[model samples]
Target: MNPLSIERLKVFPPVSNLDPSIYGPQDSALKEEQIICHLNGMSVQQAIEENKLFILDYHDVYLPFLDRINAHPTKKAYATRTIFVLTDMGSLKPIAIELSLPEKNRNGPPKCVVTPPVDATTCWLWQLGKAHVCSNDAGAHQLIHHWLRTHACLEPFIIAAHRQLSVMHPIYKLLHCHMRYTMDVNAQGRQLLLNAGGIIESHFFTAACSMEVSASVYQNWWRFDMESLPADLIRRGMAVSDATEPHGLKLLIEDYPYATDGLLIWSAIEQLVQAYVHYYYPEANIIESDSELNAWYHESINIGHADIRHASWWLKLSTPNNLISILTTIIWLASAHHAAVNFGMYPYGWYFPVRPPFMRRLVPNERDPDYTTFLADPEGYFLASLPCLDQMLHYISVLDILSTHSADEEYLGDRKDLSAWAGDPEIVEALYKFSMEMKKIGKEIEKRNGDPNLRNRCGAGISPYELLLPSSGPGVTCRGVPNSVSI
Candidate 1:
């Protein structure tokens, strides 16, 4: 594959009023003005057609912006929104709760929120950082660096009130626009919100997965599952504590036989398992046997993971049995009967909101392990690659297409013979050869003849010299096959 030619995911193109051409001087204020001008021309009819609006201010654009940043993250691409949303007025306290987006972490400022006494009447403006102050309604003329900061969790409440007045999604039941939201103002504000997509929020899910994985490894367990397996220790070549001075996952790969290949194969299996659980079982906690799987998942927190993923965990973790199969029938209910009448389409149910039905059933147990006791202890946490989540995105996109009325075309051409040769035949041959040749290799992992030497050898590092060695099999593998095929 040509690296330069392969276009990585560019899901949401940052726009200034739907036009990327408006970027000028690399300064934010000029760009905001361009966006506001662009929105002033928008209409409700226009919004329904495009199905996207620029976010205005801090309150309403929370998770939607998070989704955008997660799609394609970079520091430059992420910060542009706060530069506009937190614009200050009158040297008063800033509106947002974050004091400042610290330059320390590339992922985000910190995992938190802000809350205060803000109503529709409160006239506040942005100060430097994530703070806000009272304003006289004139534009932010200058900057103030003295404003204090708060956490991320609390900021949404006041902003939530403000979003109450913005453009309402017909399907979003709670966001009923105030009468002040004229046909004019709503159109303008929504466009600003759409343009502000990549900014205003952090990629909290990516950060959460990284943190949880690290914390789990640091704790010498996978907290999401409460299993009692020595598999974790054996796989890592270390115990729960580092008193033995044994190696962990890093050493296992470097020194163990087939460590790299086994890990890669295991990694792919993990993805397949996750997908199976999420799609087929739909309510099962498939990874719960890992002992600490749930702990690192941080199941109590509302944000930082996909709703479908979180809800699936909640369903399995809470019930552990009963009525699981029945829930899948409502997956495409379009918000239910109450939702349709309330929001004028279908009611945006509680499952999609802050207080989903599963929250009450969960009894959170955030047990922080003391990793310092481990010998030769690692100073930080474990971080797993999130290729699974990326793959899930592809799955959901395909699901969305299939769910729509427009997906009826035959995915293949009318004539199969014409399309058969389109793909590279050499790649096809490589796959066929690997599948056939790797057959005998699978048996060794399952081999157990009660011989310590054979057990150790089977589990030990694979010899690099023996990768292409010819082996015998009774027509189940590449038995007595020639090694003429170059990999």
Candidate 2:
């Protein structure tokens, strides 16, 4: 295990200390392109969602000097943080969209549009990912890399963001505390580090099904105590046998509906767990990454559960969907298991526990009742939690969901309340837009491969019309069951 050191988390060139001109986006065309998109919209969310970004799973993207977030720093000034952004543009729709293809016969100037202009015509689901920064760059990198090596974080893309409000890291303060050197250096470098952290904490881009970045760290950590898990907990099923199913499709359509009745929370967490494993594992994997986690689907995969891969995922269902289902299932399992195994039942999202000096010595310490305790609720907690703001829903809701959390706090929601300091509309927009560029490589791949065959698995058999346009022929139903749910 790598030691936790302040040196490992420091930023280099101290853009805060040095000049912004020093690190130009000239060579970083992708970065440059992202900057342009960022300047266009009112909010980061609107800009990215408008773009419709789709990321290619194989491509490895990182900061210029970053080799690995988990690797020990070779540089004297450790760069502990980095940010990620996602845009909805340049994804599957890019393939689906009609564009003038390069004519085989014509060698002249082709009139194909390189990219679409920013406008209303885009997928709503393709919105921006929050700006994310990784302070435990090394630890996080290591953890995710480890999971990925074992075939996790793949089926679903990994997502995270920096805190809402950025601030100086402990390492930064330590380095500049004495200030024998100019204060300028500390200030600038600190700002960069803080911003980077904010970007990471903003991993709003994590596929909706796979919220891996720590958005729910408190809840998850609390939920991870193995003792909390009921031994008789039904190992697998959409929901408990006694749970009542929702009444109508309207409820589901309005809310993100699930195929399984009571499986909403269950399915969600299971998917995230699979993502967690995939995230920590190494890529260039022929089986896991390439095969969509075929190695471990049905043989009873578990989140944070260290075990060898199994071929059972394939046996559970057909090809791709089987892969998708198993991967989705794993994330939910990991998260849900958090409630049972961890110290707290529901991931104490904002309610953090003390980190014991020694991992082996970590024993549960009951919350002190002698001192004033804080409850993340509609009551008891601050109206705004600051003693100076609005009502109950604002504070409690923030803890309950993403919209509220991002609105109130999210940045340093991990260790400390950093959101107040990290909040920056400009940065958030940039990150969301950045996610768009992340998908460039993937879009190019589909362009090369062209359209996937429209298979009629249930034996509608040979729809020649798939090759035809909507106006030209009949539109076909999607593959498999009219509607299906994963375990």
TM-score (all chains, Cα) for each model = 0.16, 0.18
Model 2 lDDT, residue 79, Cα: 18
Residue 148 in candidate 1, Cα distance off native in Å: 19
Candidate 2 residue-wise lDDT, 1-487, digit = tens: 1111111101111122212253232121122243344333434344334432222111112222222221222111111112122323211222111111122212121111122335422221011100011212322332232222112322211210011111243211111111111233224423532234332222211212112332222222212211111111221111123334442111211111111211333332233333433333323242334332332232133322323223232234344433334443333322222111111111222221111000111001123241133222312321111112232234223324311111111110011222422544443333334234323322432232243321211123322211101011111211111000110
- Tell me the tens digit of each residue's lDDT in model 1 across 1-487: 0000011111122222222232222212222233333333544234223422322222111221333323443211122232111111101111222211222323343222222334421211111112111110000100000000001111222233334322222101111111112233224423431123411112122222222222223233222221111233243322233345322234221222233223323332233223323432344454344333233224322333223233332334332232222121111011111111111101111111211111101010122232222112221111111123443344334323312211121110011122232344542343344334344433443342222343323434421212112232222121111211100
lDDT of 2 at 263: 34
- Model 2 TM-score relative to the real fold: 0.18
lDDT of each: 0.23, 0.23
Off by over 4 Å in 1: 1-45, 56-271, 275-487
